[model samples]
Target: MNKTVNQKAWFLVLPVLILVGFSAVIPLMTVVNYSVQDTFGNNVFFWAGLDWFRDMLESERMWNALGRQLVFSGIILAIEVPLGIFVALNMPKKGFWASFCLVLMSLPLLIPWNVVGTIWQIFGRVDIGLLGYVLAKLGVNYNYTQNVIDAWATVIVMDVWHWTSLVALLAYAGLQSIPDAYYQAAKIDQASRWKVFRFIELPKMAGVLMIAILLRFMDSFMIYTEPFVVTGGGPGNATTFLSIDLVKMALGQFDLGPAAAFSLMYFLVILLISWVFYTVMTNLDKRDGV
Candidate 1:
């Protein structure tokens, strides 16, 4: 029996498709065009083929930036995931305090990225900022602008403060979805806290945790505004990530062709890594029967 398919849904989605084409596809096409051709003012363009890509691949500056980016992302995931889960596990399950705690946890995520960076910038000044002044009084040699280790620590702490709440909130939501029956059953079985968590909660929260890991990974990998504003990719390029280097090439030095190629490679790396993360997590979930 053949029935007529309803095609009306296409009309509703047409606007969104057109918008995406204009916003994403058009800009990507322009980047591709710029990446393959070199311009010598007066609107004259010469075919450069894959020269820019080859140069970027061989460049030590790009490699250094990539290493820094990878380390930052790895540190963020390691700290934020476990910390967030711990927080969610300790949060109140219900009532007024739950509401208050939820609001408090959301406060950091509500602030603008640049504003967060600016706030930290001021808050870390040794002469005036509360944190720095106190540390100085205690004789702690903490200077993000001068010391490489201090700069890395400050940025890592800043990101953890800003984004850990997001992971906690997601984990909290996952916990909320679990039925009370599971806990009751665990109690009846006289299962230990660790056993219950391993057998029940961990498996249940795996999906959301995977989501949190992926989101944090992608965001940390592509991070720009906060660190740029706070450290300005300084302290002798110790904090310079790929995004900062790309900006220096495209705008600071006006190396459009190379910058475009660099950006495309950046995009591909993020995409590839994200795919790997997704695949590995999905396999783990399947193996665990989650």
Candidate 2:
């Protein structure tokens, strides 16, 4: 005799489905509507076909912002990934110090994004901020407001300080999951530190490393508030990434049609990259017998 499956469990998820439809699907549909139409005041909208999309595709301003965003994300990944791994490796594996280190690493990740920006903004001031004051006192001529290089460095360092903890935490979790047997076998073989890390540790951490990479990539690409608060996209628009540009179009200039088009394209780029990362992660899991 075959046993019947209970289908009533489906009802349990209905409320969540309704909530997502209202929160996500409806808003996405509204954006789609705005993307293909032009609107004036008083809710009057005219069909513009793909005019806004074509215009966005051709806009040099958008292209420049895209270039800047790609550079920033690339820099962040290059610096954070290895640094996080190194930190995780050096952390105490067991004891009170391990718990203390974990807590310290988590503190940065817990701070609000806007607050991180504000803290950095005040902290980098050339005259009043400690960093700026020290640099000025040492006659380094540091001013993020006036110097493009200084502004870029400040933003990059701030991001590293704030988000490196996340990478460390993930890597630490990956490290914790490695069984003692692996270490014992390596030790029995008289394996060197580098060899053990290369053959044993790195391979085991691959899954979590990929996850950390994907999360960091998406977050860095879509970063807006922190950089916006710190720089205001100033110093001649040196730090204005795609998100800031989209906001300027949508709200600053009140160009809804183009802004919606820009946003959709932005979403597609992120979706495509995320798909690629997911594919890599799945393949890694298969190879690692995870």
Best model per TM-score: 1
Clashes of each: 0, 0
lDDT of 2 by residue, 1-290 (tens): 99889999899999999999999999998998999999887899999999999999999999999999999999999999999999999999999999999999999999999999999999999868999999999999889988999999999999999999999999999999999999999999999999999999998898899989999999999999999999988788899999999999999999999999999999999999999889987986787675
Q: Which stretches of candidate 1 lie over 4 Å from their true place?
A: 5-13, 288-290
Inter-residue clash pairs, candidate 1: none
**What 10-residue stretch in candidate 2 is worst by lDDT?**
281-290
lDDT of 1: 0.94
Give the Å error, residue 205, model 1.
0.6
**Superposed Cα deviation of residue 19, candidate 1 (Å):** 1.1
| lDDT against the true structure, each candidate | 0.94, 0.94
In the order shown, what is each candidate's alpha-carbon RMSD?
A: 1.6, 1.7
Cα error, residue 240 of model 1, in Å, equals: 0.6
Cα-based TM-score, every candidate: 0.96, 0.95
lDDT per residue, candidate 1, 185-235, as tens digits?
A: 999999999998898888889899999999999999999999999899989
